[model samples]
Target: MQRRARTYLTGVALAVMLSGGLTACTGSPEDEGGEDTKAGSSGAPDSSAPPGRYRTLPEPCGAVDLSTLKKLLPDAEGAPQGSSTPGKGTASGDEESPYEGQPIATYDTDRRAGCRWKSTNSLATRNLTVDFERVVSYDPAVSDDEQAQLLYDERAGQAEIPTESEPPADEEGGEGGDPADEGGKSGSGGSGEDGGSEAADSGTDGKGGGEGGGDPGGEGEKSDSGGGSDASEEPGGEPSPSSDADLSPRTLDDIGDNAYIDDQLDTGDSGVHRDITLVFRSANVIATVTYDQWLTDKRRTPDSAELQEKARSVAEELAADFDDN
Candidate 1:
């Protein structure tokens, strides 16, 4: 009887201890999963970033159409191969057709590619190159587009082009009309919505008159004064030589997602040559078009406006093609 009683007491004590241990475990750290911040397979945030938009780049050799090539390069009587063109290689190879550009060599076509075309005429030697780059992000936390944006910004900075906020060549001194505007009688009245100067007398009418003063003529004189006398005209009205700031390298608003034009007139021993480069980015791809014109006459400078226009035209076409395909 004594032995059986001891056994029952021992069993009761063990049951009580187990009950207390279970109660403590219910409120322990392991049970509070909802409050836990630790990351596990299912609980961790995603590390993979979004993929780039472009999987492949366009054919660099065919980026510019034949019509554009003809417009940019010399049409006839190109200098013999291995001539004085700076970028043109002097390899003793067969003469290349101006219509077909030589493909830029690269080990990985998927990442980057480019092409070059050159032609020479009595007037000038023209060289055009087009390049394409596809950016891939190495970090899983950053998307390819973000990586591309960073790279493009760095290049733009390195180009040393003026910021958009900087005044153009035209506005460097005082902001006003160009010389062409000064020659006209526009100084007699405020900007005319009608050729008849309808607003000239309207200022007298309370409803349609000028905002502050009723005299529109005074407004014209103020604008003219702000611009000073025509910079293109001398004191005696002689046609003085003029330089416009529109030719300066500046950021473009509409070529691509982000774009800029770099205009440089190099007057070196080689000769006077103007280079206009247009660079733009779309999605994860970047495109660059470099148009070079080397004038045969060193005395005359290559027309910056003309080169910039041509480069912009090519860039627009390339961008449109990218959108279409």
Candidate 2:
């Protein structure tokens, strides 16, 4: 009986310890309720971040239309091939074929992509390249247009083209009136018959004198008028400003959201080559087209009109593709 009673007391002590441990492990209902409430009240996450305009980019090689490519690179060996696959010389045995145009591979397809094509004739060669870039703004406080404008400004600066800024008010007001006033003065002077008659009469009177004093005076007036005309013929009638063509890049209006063209000419013993680079921004994407042509005849250079026309066509096609996407 004593042994049994001792066992029962030991069991009761163990039960008390287990009950206390359970109470400590489990918190009060109020505390549990508070945690549940806190989790529920967290609500939705902050979504104030401004979204980027472009989420994806088009295929680099296929961005430009095949017909356009054919026109640009008429002598090219074959259709363009993508760099996604290995060229034939590679161990993979999937190397790009000689017939396939050159593929300009980029590390990131979603951000940047480009392709190139070249064809050589007996005496000349032609090359065409196209690139596409997707712009993404990281700043949440800035809008897409603002971000795009900033990027465009940077590109314009690099191309050495004019930015979209208002002309100085003073310059506008002064220059705006001068041309109109000069035109009016010229028109009135031309139409005034009385002045012409007076001049003619004076000339006749001077001619009557054997010394011909009027002839010298008339020649002097004619020389003075010729000099004035030459001055007026100059750009804006002031000392002619330097032409920006060879020195600075040119901005193109009516092309994409903004556009510019850069022309570079390289002359070597073999021949002269001209490279025309055209860049246009549409929405959050920028498309660059480079057209290069080599002429064996040193006297000949690539046609600017043809190059620009082709480049603009390719750019438009790329922009359309972006729109479709």
Best by lDDT: 1
Give me the runs in candidate 1 sitting further than 4 Å from their true place: 1-49, 76-97, 162-245
- List the candidates' TM-scores in order: 0.60, 0.54
Q: Write model 2 residue lDDT over 1-325, tens digit each, in one string.
A: 9999999999999999999988877767768889988776664223234566677776665555555665665545443443432222122245553233455656788876666666555545666666766666566655454555556655555434556642333433434567855543333222221224432432232222212011212221100000111212222112322333232357777667888776655554534555566777777776777766565556655454455556668777766766666
List lDDT for all candidates, in order.
0.58, 0.53
Candidate number achieving the greatest TM-score relative to the actual structure:
1
Q: Over all chains combined, what TM-score does candidate 1 have?
A: 0.60
Q: What TM-score would you give candidate 2 relative to the actual structure?
A: 0.54
What is the per-residue lDDT of model 1 for residues 1-325, given as tens digits with 9 covering 90 to 100? Answer: 9999999999999999999999888868666774565545444457777899889988876677666655555442254442222223222456544455667666789987777666665566667777787888888887888777666655554455444323344544344566534532222222212212211121112111111112222221100001112211211112222334465666788977888787666566656566667888888887888776666566665665556767788899889888776
Tell me how candidate 1 scores on lDDT.
0.58
Model 1 clash tally, residue pairs: 1
lDDT of 1 at 190: 20
